[model samples]
Target: MRGVVLHAPGDVRVEERDDPVIVAPTDAVIRLSATCVCGSDLWPYRGVEEVDGPSPMGHEYVGVVAEVGGEVRDVRPGQFVVGSFFASDNTCELCRAGYQSSCVHRVPIGGIGAQAEYLRVPLADGTLVATPGTPPDDLVPSLLAASDVLGTGWFAAVAAEVGPGKTVAVVGDGAVGLLGVLAARQLGAARIIAMSRHESRQALALEYGATDIVTERGDEGVARVKDLTDGLGAHSVIEAVGTQESMMQAIRSTRPGGHVGYVGVTHDVALPGMDLFFSHVHLHGGPAPVRRFLPELVDLICDRRIDPGKVFDLTLPLDRAPEGYEAMDERRAIKTLLTV
Candidate 1:
């Protein structure tokens, strides 16, 4: 088997590795059919996030089950499945309460990189959700999208309570934020404002359901959002970029009693207590509890209500994942899909 490994910053390679096997009763082995490069993967690739030794690299995946442990009954061999980045025993108190990301037995599903021929999935019954049989060839990308970005965007919309009669603002024009606009529209948001300086991404955002596009930066961006909302600010703001600037933009663009649903993988960011206190805005975000929304999102995709896979502007072979990283880091691609 071959998997992606990061030997150090700015160095990603495809190396031969031993295949994974079921190690626990709740485990399952999957042969990846499709995988992708996430924005967070760039942190290590760009040398922002330190990497000591060789480490496996992907978290979003969609594949066919190769083997299942004795205790894994819900998922079986030969079934196509999609799973969240975090593995959890879905029956835990937190999971039962719809917060699988904080499950008592939660396990970070990072060891077996999805950009590989085969990998192991822990807590199969609780972590993996089987799709409606094998989907059409074109639907594979959409199903793979549901494994992470789509679900995260959907969670962001739900967190912000985006629905009919509300104005929503989305910061960050990355894949997640673009899909957040789509999710907001699907959730019934009357006005969807997408803040992006890139013309290509802004175009895609419009195609996905953005009611307006604002190509402003920093404070100007916040002012544009407020101006569009008649100085009251948007009722809900989705922060998909986890930088300090993006976070502040999200908080400042939202109305006093509005909510900020942030799903960006935070890095080196510090929130100002006084600013938040004075703003009276509600903040909620972390690793998205994707499992909680998996069932509904799966149904929506299966029934053709949404096509989040459109975000993948470039596709590459698994062996050429380094190119995918470069394309994203250079801003040449919005999202890259790797076929196994």
Candidate 2:
């Protein structure tokens, strides 16, 4: 089997690796059908995140179950499934409370890496959701998106309590933020403001039902959003960039008492406690409980209510992952899809 491995920053390669097998009674082995590169992958690619040795890379995946452990009864071999980036025993207290990302037995899929021919998923019954059946060829990408970005965006919208009659602001124009705009619209946000400087992404945001687009940066961006909202700021703000600047923008663009749903994989960030205390803004974010929203997102994708795959502007073979990384890092592609 072949998988993507990062030897070091600026060095990603596809090399032969041993195929994964069911190692636990709660585990399942999946033969990946599709996978993708995430924005967070760039951290290591750009040398921002340290990598001491060869490490597998990828989390978002849609695949067919090749085998299942003895304890995994719900998901059987040959079933097509989509799973959250974080694997969790859905019966845990946190999972039962709808926070599977924080489950007591949770395991992050990226740590194991899904950008390969096969992946071993822990807590199989809890983490993997079987699709209606083998979906149409075109629907594969959408289902794959549900495994991460779509689910994260949906979680962000829910965290912010976005719904009818509320104004929502989305910071960051990456795939997750773009999907956040879509989530806001589906959640009944009356007005969706997507803050982006990229024309292409902004256009897609509009197509996804964004009511307005702000092309400014930093304070100017917040001012534009406030101006559009009559100086009250948005009722809900989705922060998808996971950076200091983007976080500040989200907080500033949101009205007092408004909610901020941040789903970006936080890197080096230090929140100002005083500012947050004074602003009276509510903040909620961490690894998204994608499992909590998996069922609904799967139904939406199956019914074609949303086309989250639009985020993948470029598709490449799994072996060409290096090019995929370069394209995304160079801003030449919004997201990259890898076909196994």
Q: Extract clashing residue pairs from model 2.
A: none
RMSD of each: 0.8, 0.7
Could you tell me which 10 consecutive residues in candidate 2 have the lowest summed lDDT?
277-286
Write out the backbone clash pairs for model 1: none
- The 10-residue segment of model 1 with minimum total lDDT is 106-115
lDDT of 1 by residue, 309-337 (tens): 99999999999999999999999998899
Put down candidate 2 lDDT per residue, 1-340, tens digits, no spaces.
9999999999999999888988999999999999999999999999999997899999999999999999988999999999988999999899999999999998989889899999999999999999998999899999999999999998998998899999999999999999999999999999999999899999999999999999998999989999999998999999999999999999999999999999997798888999898878989988899999999999999999999999999999999999999999999999999999
lDDT of 1 at 53: 86
| Each prediction's whole-model lDDT (CA) | 0.91, 0.94
Relative to the unseen true structure, what is the C-alpha lDDT of residue 135 in candidate 2, on a scale of 0 to 100? Answer: 93
Best by lDDT: 2
Q: What overall lDDT, based on C-alpha atoms, would model 1 receive against the true structure?
A: 0.91
